[model samples]
Target: MNELISQAIAQWQLMHSIELVATLLALAYVILALQQSLWCWPAALLSTVLFTHVMWQSALLSDALLQLYYAGMALYGWWRWQQLKQGSAGSRGPVYEWPWQRHCWLIMATAVAGLALGAVMANYTHAEFAYLDAQTTVFSVMATWLVARKLVSNWLYWVVIDAVSIYVYAQKHLYFLTGLFMLYTVIAIAGYFIWRSHYQQQPAVRLSV
Candidate 1:
């Protein structure tokens, strides 16, 4: 156990400065987002930019591309949240729940897309863990959109994505990133219960409006 701890520490110590910065920013974003704070968008944007560069350097092309998508989504999420705040008298928007049927469709779509991306990357690129990378990337995009829309189920999706991401990063010897995702999994679980409770307490009038 001591030897394993030492190895993990050494790997973490070797992480790039930008990766550390990104991780910190990402943690901040998740915490704020869980609390339904609008400030999370800016933090997410900065973190995604740094993470994009870090993933590219690490040869995780799918993850790098996902980060680029996240950068763009950050802007959209910011604007959308601002609109929600203004429309609702400066309060965070109501949390929403999608129908089970819609989620089933989304899951099917993500799986198909992941398989296609995995096949392309396996055939044409040196990307490692292509299927797993694609799975996380595709689902993460969906989850981010759900978060932007204030969906209560977004945390559920993130729980699965973050858990898988921990393994992916660990396989690449990115101990810092692996640890970050592990924390993300816990945060995602907490976010789910927190949002659910808030949703339950929300005025029916507000939801109808």
Candidate 2:
């Protein structure tokens, strides 16, 4: 395992040219979004475009497609969050959540979709470690939905997604990326608690309102 890790790090360092920077940029985007900064969307858009190219270079077509999803989501999230904020009628921020009912639906739907995606990847794709990749991909689609909604619980999804990506990237010898995911694991924990506290203060802002 140590030898493999070392080998992974060696190769990753050699390929650190553009992708590494894009990864860090993406991380910064998430950090800002966690802090409830709307600017994070545009900041993330740059990384997504950069990653599209980087993933193409790595021949990760699905992963590259993930960046395209990010682009679309970023636009949607930017618009949605802005409208919510503007609609706040004064000082209220738009950090509200989906009701628990909708939340459960998101989870159930995400699970079913993730399973279907995993099967397709496991059976029909050239994606490295296909089951895991597809699982992460589908989780991401769900997670992206949550983020767009500005649901505080999205941080919990981030933790799960990051945990899964750690193993996925590690196997692909993307050690730097794996390390970044480990950092995301830590950040997700912080983000969850932080967002939770924020939501607790604003419990009055349920989806109905």
Candidate 3:
């Protein structure tokens, strides 16, 4: 057990600084998004760009495409957040609750979208692990959309995605990043419950204003 743990530690310690920086930015985005902060989209976009280059350089073509998708989502999310802003109240910006139903629909839609992307990737690009790649990308797109919409269940998708990402990263010897995703799993679970509880107390309202 000690040997195994030591090996894991050494492997992680050998990870490059660039990858470490990308993970930090990713985590920062998640934490900010969880707090319902509008800055999450832009911050997350920075991480996406960094990771895109990293993945492309590492020849993880599918992952590079995923980051490009994330870039697009970030733009949409930024716009969505602008709509959510209720203007500054004194010093702080106003915020509002989101309906849980939106999250449900988003998840369902993502599954369908993933199937379509998988078909295209399998037919055209030299995308390795085509189906799995498309699925993760699509799920992430949906999850990001939910976050942008201020939906409470966005973290639920993260919980699932992060779990899978950990194994995938480990298989590729990205031990440090695998550990980062593992840590994110705990945060995602906590965020899910916290946001759910908050959602429960919201009064009936059509719009978030």
Candidate 4:
């Protein structure tokens, strides 16, 4: 019994260390993202890589998959941001706003995709909050893409996503991650206003894009 308890304590310590490291990296990613710094992608890449393992260990399969996707997006976002910085061909310069109609269509498509993913996970896996997990994963994918594109509205999407994520992480007893998401919610709210200010300052030529 003592040996079993010792093993459990060691396991808990390991998990706690991993979660703490990932949480700090994720926090850095968000702060850099809000600043529109290229370094954010590298931070995100590292955080998601750690989180993929952490979420899998926690039995949050969809969340694990989302972290994998985030890892990929981190690479893409880095390249995309670099292109923008260099004023390369096909790069949309700086912060820009997308049409409301586009966002409406995007929301509908992702919502349907989330429901479908949730149904599959519910029927096939012993996943917790399958529907909710799928919804957050799908929307987060979209929001991450919007961030890569430098869309001003992505922060608004994150505000909602991060708020929901607090509940999700809390349910899993990931207190540190829940607190991180809480911070994410506040940062996202600030990011929206800050990005909007940047958008308003962009050159008229870029605004027409």
How high is the lDDT of residue 89 in model 1? Answer: 48
RMSD (CA, Å), candidate 4 to true, equals 2.4
Leading candidate by lDDT: 4
lDDT (Cα, tens digit) per residue for candidate 1, span 1-209: 99999998876565567788899999999999998998999999999998997898778989999999999999998998888778774378777776788889989998999999989878899898988898898899889999988888999999999999998899887777888999999999999999999888876533211
lDDT, candidates in the order shown: 0.88, 0.77, 0.74, 0.90
3 or 4, greater by TM-score? 4
lDDT, model 3, position 32: 80
Per-residue lDDT tens digits of candidate 2, residues 13-131?
65675677878888898788878788889988888888787666665656777889999999998898788778775343656566678778777887787678767766676666655
Supply candidate 4's per-residue lDDT for 86: 88
lDDT preference between candidates 1 and 3, better one: 1
Q: Which pairs in model 1 have colliding backbones? A: none
TM-score of each: 0.89, 0.83, 0.77, 0.95
lDDT of 4 by residue, 71-161 (tens): 9999999998888878843333578887798889989999999999999889999888899999999999999988998889999999988
Clashing pairs in 2: none
lDDT of candidate 3 over 1-209, digit per residue (tens): 99999997875554456688888888888788767677888888898887887677655576788899888888988887776565433221333455568557766888888888888878887766677767887887667666766666678888999898887778777665788899899999988887776666554435442
